[model samples]
Target: MTATARPAEKPAMPHFSSGPCAKRPGWSVEALKGAAVGRSHRAKVGKTKLAQAIDLTRDVLQVPADWRIGIVPASDTGAVEMAMWSLLGERPLDLLAWESFGSGWVTDALKQLKLKDAREIKAGYGKLPDLSAVNFDHDVVFTWNGTTSGVRVPNGDFIPADREGLTICDATSAAFAQRLPFDKLDVVTFSWQKVLGGEAAHGMLILSPRAVERLETYKPAWPLPKIFRLTSGGKLIEGIFKGETINTPSMLAVEDYIDALQWAKSVGGLDGLVARADANTKAIADFVAKVDFLDFLAEVPETRSNTSVCLTFKDPAVASLDDAGQQAFVKAFTGFLEKEGVAYDIAGYRDAPPGLRIWCGATVETADVEALMPWLAFAFEKTKTEMAQAA
Candidate 1:
């Protein structure tokens, strides 16, 4: 094969993509120096940092006194899976899925575990599953926020307090941006690469006392992996809830998470973070209101997400185009924005419908989101022009 030439230089502009979202202000070189590198995670310094992280999370989130937080293996996915494999065998499961992530959990329950009696409630991308019809007697699994569809559960009011089952929630994008009622939640999971804007590879799992009891009492019929085994021989491993992680962790990533947490504290804690996310979402809402063709993918304002905002065009701008044409147009539009350095990685998920998905998390400023709107308009206009010319 012929050798490929390297690029002479890199592009310069702000990047605003979801998932590995934009970093906090001044998070480049200066931030790296403060990170604890070349150190064992089991060292005293590493343990101290990990403990500080847990404390800060508790402080910012205002978690209950009895609840416990720990760093879990992998990212948010691992945390959720660990909970599923460890504590979900005793009761019938109600898996609610309205979007991609929740659907993934359903797949795990049906295909992976082959659970014959798992009740699956589903809806379209922008809508929520019917919670009123859910059985409170069974264990529940759900994603608090649908990142791909930009929809979220309005609150925990739908959950019944007297229910016998546990509620396991995947709150990766909703952790810092929205309110989560710990009292109603049994197992909550989130990742560092979400609303807090930290590096990936680590997940935080918060367990209520009920979840712990489930882990200690009931064992799954399936074989358990070493990392997912929170209980051994009918005993809760209390040390895991402390600074003791199951496997060796990247100290550098841990330090990065600390930096993000410190940044979260400096900005006035969880309330401030929520306000920032709200402001960004309002900016997009206002823009969407004025635009003729653009509409939010979320069905209702109350259920809309403040972090990931998905949009779809309503006009006949590219309706007549074939699937290939639509794909080409989307590629060109995203490519234009990327090359212009106005935005990065704003493309909708491949499995979802054709649209644009923007990250409006806490770390992203409202001013930056506002600044990018006109560029989106510019890209849309260019794409339309190209499509009309092709016609």
Candidate 2:
């Protein structure tokens, strides 16, 4: 195949990173000029801003009124780890893992927490564990979306409504862009830097009434750190849910989040956010359908992620390469695109299969994704020629 001509137009914003994703449409530093800098987060104005962030999160996510939502430290990882350390030892746990992040939780449960009864239900990249095999009688830990592998749980139907245990979900990549069934999830965690395109360093933890009950009734055998403590004297510290953070917070990042939340609301909130991501993924799907070598890493369309869209080369020549060779190829492929200023951070995750990963979250414009398709084809053809000439 002959190499194609350079694309006439490029994406206006070339930020396609999976984390610290693209900023909301029309976002600017000017939007955060009102950040309450130099003021104590505990003070009236700072506290008001903090409370507003929490309130806006709840409203935009459509969280249940009774659910406790708090802004915690250490982004989504911290939130998920905190939930695991605080809640898992009390029951037999079932940990489902399909990708790096989910597998990390499994290791935390069995090695770090050393829970004797914890069972790992696992699948390789691009597939999901059997949801029917999950025991709802035991506490469950899973990721709503596998950011590395580009697979996601299909829906909440797998979770039994009248379960005997809690469901703790790491929804860092799924929230805002996906329909999360709050009633099915006991604890949900996400970072500010994901679908909403806000700054990092903080995580939002949402707790159903059942999760709170577990917190008050059951305490872990290990000592809890001040940062991870959700309860004191076996009583839920209700203030945290009301914007009283455990430690000082970045007011600037909080302000950025507020701006993103406002943008989310302006775009019709959750429904609109989901629609934008859906459109972005659809554009990529169309592109993949026309291209012979590129295909989704996710074998099942139903489980394919709309946010972190992962792709692999289908050509037997490229697919026949060893792991290191494939990695080198992807590195060169991504570097080629970067050099052209067509994309950035589109490399597949280090732990994932060799391929490309693109962020198609709500903040990414569909027109930009559409414009990017031709460039990908051009890059592939050009890269293939370079590899052949070298051989």
- Estimated TM-score for each candidate: 0.95, 0.99
Clash list (residue pairs), candidate 2? none
Q: Candidate 1 lDDT (Cα, whole model)?
A: 0.85
Per-residue lDDT tens digits for candidate 2, residues 215-239, read 9999899988999999988899999
Output the TM-score of candidate 2. 0.99
For model 2, the local distance difference test gives 0.94
Q: Which residue runs of candidate 1 sit more than 4 Å off their true CA positions?
A: 1-13, 320-323
User: What residue runs in model 2 are displaced by over 4 Å at the alpha carbon?
Assistant: none
Error of 1 at 181 (Å): 0.6
Candidate 1 TM-score, true structure as reference: 0.95
